[model samples]
Target: MYTDNCYSKIDNISVEYWRVGIYCRLSKEDEGTGQSESINNQREFLKKYVNDAKWTLFKIYIDDGYSGLNFERPGFQDMINDIESGLVNLIIVKDLSRLGRDYIQTGYYLEKYFPEKRVRFIAVNDCIDTFRESAANDFSPIRSVFNDMYAKDISKKVRTAFNIKRAKGQFIGSHAPFGYLKDPDNKNKIIVDEEAARIVKRIFEMYLGGMGLTTIAYTLNEEGVPNPSRYKKTVLNSSYVGRNKTMYWDATTIKWILTNPTYMGSMAQGKSEKLSYKSKKFINIPRENWQIVEGTHEPIVSKQEFETVQKMIERKNNQDFKCRKTPRLFSGFVYCGDCGSYMTYNAKRNHLYLICSTYKRFSKEFCSRHSIQEKTLISIVIEDMVQMIQKYVDVNGIKDKTVGLSFKDGKKKEIQDDIKRCRDRLEELKAMVKSLYTDKVKGIISEEDFLELNKGFTDEKNGINEKLQKLEKKLAELDRKEDEKREIEDIAKKLLEFKTLDRFILEKLIEKIEIYENAEIKIHYKFLNPDK
Candidate 1:
């Protein structure tokens, strides 16, 4: 009950315009079955069908070793291009599953896209013709769903097999890790590559010998020793293209090599997995979730040596963390009103004072030291806090009619500029650290000198970071001035019980305190003009 004249009657187009394109697909799971689903079988069957239909054969598009779960195949895209260009008006496939197994996409193309594009589609084995009205055409969606289920089943089986192999300590990756090679007798097994293993052992030794990661990388690069990726391509004769442009080692590469447990004779697998059967993206599994089988291969570094290196790295990181400068009472809340720079704390024989950082660090031509006594600043801040609490109690709000009560546009711009300057300085500090490592490696600076200079830089970096955080918070409050009444009232209520200013209370109540050369202070409250 199939009619060949369905498309001709519907579009009023003649058979001379019917240029047929035959599409054949053979998935990896379908290969070596020696069945009718072979690539050649599908191609020949579809070709004969097109010839018998008295249609002009435009071209044969074939996608071999492709998954039916996805439609990113090269040949499929090429056929679509011809269809859009009006070179092929009809498409013939051996079966529906050959076109695609994704049920949603298959349904879209069959029921909507093909009809809108004015292209006729035919599946020879499935007895499907988009232009024809038949029971088989109506049942296409159900058949597509079944095909999708089959694909999902196949994917699950493949993943289960891979996991089984991983549990058995088999190597399943396409290429071995940098320090090993796949066993010649068994591809699932690995053996140490002495050439690369020697380099791996030397990296551990260099770290234990007090050479930093950057220094080790620089020393290896200076010796013209090829990095892991370069060694794989040139020495091991591999076709790996990953990180191919990196001809020299870096601190990141050195760290990964040091932290990885593979060099200690453990076979680590299942470190990552595909997001889903239909997605090409992979998500990394946590370290504890990875399947690790120890003593699976020869270890380049002994377990004891590896454990020692890990502890050393941890201790170094802890030292750096502990050395960061702790926040002082008015550390980030004070600034120089004259130079618009943060004021640095100076304790001169128990008499604490804040001086303009710009004048203290650089030439005095840049700025004057707007010094103010710490005790005077504290008294001014406490008075302002009491005034704020009284205002809130007087009118049940903090809004005042004073001209300077609200944050001006000029103050907002200054905060934005400070953020930009801090970000730029951070970048410069990064470059300086890199240069410091290079200097240490080249003997341009002694170990003692490097440590001394690095400590100073670290302190300055930490202080700038604290100042940036306070500036950003002030800017955010200025932008979101509305809907902050309740929060401001709560803080004012707490200030009523405090007579002296502490670090936490000062930070919560005041945004910034600008000091001038005459010991004058201007307090910018966090909830200035709260009712507005």
Candidate 2:
């Protein structure tokens, strides 16, 4: 009976059919620290074992400077593809830890994936072989747990060290801010770059001279000055991409530089932190939570000048500068009918009128200047409102007007369905982009094909996002109009008692007032008009 069972087991041990794929990984922490764990050393050792066993060496895969915590490495993914294609029947690594550091995934691959795929796996240093039954194979799970613990410990220690460095007011960032550079003598300190510092000073001077942010950006771009992003790549030789196709100066970039305290000799650190050690996502830290150390670097602008500029920026943003104390009644409601630009509020010489902002700011060639007096607009709006109130009073006869203010269900449902489809497509596109990047990294797809597909995906994504924004804005406007309509209808019920108009009631009744040529006026009410 024993001889018969031995013959049956011998028939299944097919060693000659083994096609081996040797895998090796060397992270930054492991490189040059251990000679035995080096890529070349791991390759030679695994090859010797395969030769001794008389197995065919099909290919060797290496993931140099890649962490074992994630299985997204290009070389590792290539080996998995070969196994699925039936090209590789066996895989060998230096040790169990070489496969991965994450215990859950490493265990899943070794215990389930390899077995289900009918492929053999081995770790020479750990004496693990799936084809042969051994005590070492049973202990692999415990080993994986230890490896995971080691990675966590290392991550904690590195974070603690960085925190200590930041507390000392040291400049630990890879690149200095726009107007500064890392000191040659001490990398932890920063000094002003004279060439860039001159540009920084010019920006401050322009702002103080009553030049708007957009005008300053346009002047710098017209002068052929490289933006901060282009300067870093071409001049500073950093790997960070500006992500700007044209690399032109813009108001957003100017505002960032203007607001940064670094120019005033303060070193701000820990502005953002990663979600976790395993994930690459980062969340920005609030300004109050940021670690700020004053006088940690050379000053590019005086403290007094910086404080004055900050105060001016605050005052301009408050909306009080345009009207001197409070916003006008029709300040935000008027627009130009021809060019569709917001109308500027003019109160010059006791004359109140709204004119096309585009014509006032830019050349007349871009747009036409059409003006309508505020008094005339109010008169027109109040007269139309009174007519509507008379119609409602004739029909309803002073009854409650706030009971039924909701719009028809058909319109709301159509908009809601469109929003749902757009949101679903956005999620699908995000997943597709991630998969496309992985395929490109694994060499399954060519670079040219990837770029073409990526561009198409990006265009579709941008269009979907813009559509969603518009749809959401439209829905919000509809809801706000319904509520305002109810409020105005209540006031309209009392329109016969008080035949007067105020800013509050006018604003609640009208969404926009458009000024056209030949002194023509068009009013867009928040609520629907039965007369129209």
Candidate 3:
């Protein structure tokens, strides 16, 4: 019901001709819409009150299944707009709680918005009317506070109930997953939907039969097989379901189905958590922390088939990593000496070759090809590794066809000092940028000045950051050399090793193989001679 503008006194302005609006809201979740007089009863009572006062009935605003905790309700927003536009001079609700359960917004409307607009407010059931003086007005604010607290308490109770259901291996999500339906007898439990389960099986079968994920999705879409979203919306007719613009099988959806343990009769809960009672944001919880209950229901797929499919998926991923256009086992371990860029590994169907990345991009204009056969490079590195061990790691070892690692003219201290200075300068620049932003917000500087000065500082900081990065790379190279030397020394002392080259040995001993024009190669080992 609306307020009694006729009964309230406001600077001798009579309520006889005042325009009145009645608002009623019912959230089916929290408030049972069918219970008591409810919305219909509230509307009828409001119409009668306006008639009794002989006031003009502007309109009746009703928001069904909407939360009063927020003022974003369409009906409520329309009422507020009308009030501001002078279309309605007085507002009324069934009670203060009916208007809203948020104390801050409710109090603001009662104390500030309504008064400023010269509009009278009334809550009939609460017996507080601005038109007529009563002690209820004094308690209205306190009552609204209680309403907010009630909403929070109710929210907590509902969450507790949901958690209890979830812990019992029950499916508490708004909609059951694609291949299953909520059990009719016990809504918390799930029962497989045979029709949807068939589709799920087909998807997995196609994937395990060597079909790509995207290809399987395309085939399903071509066949007009309803995706998870479509099945929920059209077949199941779930009220909470939202249809996607294009209801077709997608790779991401297919992948989720394949990965889900639910199809194997496993129950999972606590995959996500809301920020707090008032916040609507939800963050994903790690899988390790998820509550699981095995053999919760009849599985759509066998665990054995599911595990085999997982292995197939892993093999496919590894193959992709190995044959990615020009993938190489020595990837990240080959570089162009001239341009200082890693060489690209290319498989020419018959032979493997390495080409400078810079040369490939711009031909000889940037840098020479620095190309070399994979076999030739391997032979050169093996020879160098043996020589390195005999000269440095094993000074008194038996003779080997190799050169020794030399360590002279090392500038460890100077490089370390430069790195420390760059870091300190970078920190200072970050602090200055932060202070500049604060000054701009405080209006101590104009926007134009702030933009120009901030850009200058950022550019200077970026330049210093680049120098720091180069220094770090240099330091890492030095550290890698020391580590390689120690490892090789230990190996050589054990078995006079460093003869054959395996993938593991190559990765551990060599940092990168630099190729130059005219088939020249440079072996940059973990323990590279500093003077070289």
Best candidate, lDDT-wise?
1
Q: Give per-candidate clash totals.
A: 0, 0, 6
Candidates, ranked, lDDT: 1, 2, 3
Give lDDT tens digits, candidate 2, residues 1-532.
0112323464476677888999999886677467998999999999999999888999999999887788999999999999999999889999988999889999999888998887778999899877666788888999999988877777787678778878888988877888888899999899998988999999999998998776687678768788888787787887665434346777777878887888888888899887876777889999899888898878888888788888988887674465566547777888888888999876657778777876665435456668777777777877877876675555544333323354565887799899999999999999999999999999999999999999999999999999999999988977886665557667776655686777777666667878886677787766555544
Location of the lowest summed lDDT over 10 successive residues in candidate 2 = 1-10
> Candidate 2: deviation at residue 508, Å?
12
Quote the lDDT for 153 in model 3.
Answer: 83
Please report the candidate that would top TM-score against the real structure.
2
* Residue 61 accuracy (lDDT) in model 2: 93
Model 2's TM-score against the true structure: 0.59
- Candidate 1 per-residue C-alpha lDDT over 1-532 given as tens digits, one digit per residue, 9 for 90 to 100: 2244664585566667788899999998777557798988898888788777677998999999999987889999999999889898889998899999999999888887787777889888889988877788989999999999988888898899889988988889888888899999999998999999999999999999998876687678768788888898899887785433576677778887888888898888998999888899999999899999888888999999888998998897786575435346788989988888999876567577888876664435456778787888788788777876785554445544322334554887898999999999989988898899899999999999999988988998999999999999988887666335445556666677667668767766678989887767888876554444
Off by over 4 Å in 1: 1-15, 32-35, 183-185, 233-247, 317-532
Worst 10 residues of 1 by lDDT: 396-405
RMSD of each: 24.4, 17.5, 15.1
Report the error of model 2 at residue 232, Å.
Answer: 3.4
Residue pairs that clash (backbone atoms under 3 angstroms), model 3: 2-92, 7-131, 8-131, 387-402, 387-403, 481-526
Score residue 284 of candidate 3 by CA lDDT: 94
Q: Better model by lDDT, 2 or 3?
A: 2
Error of 2 at 3 (Å): 25
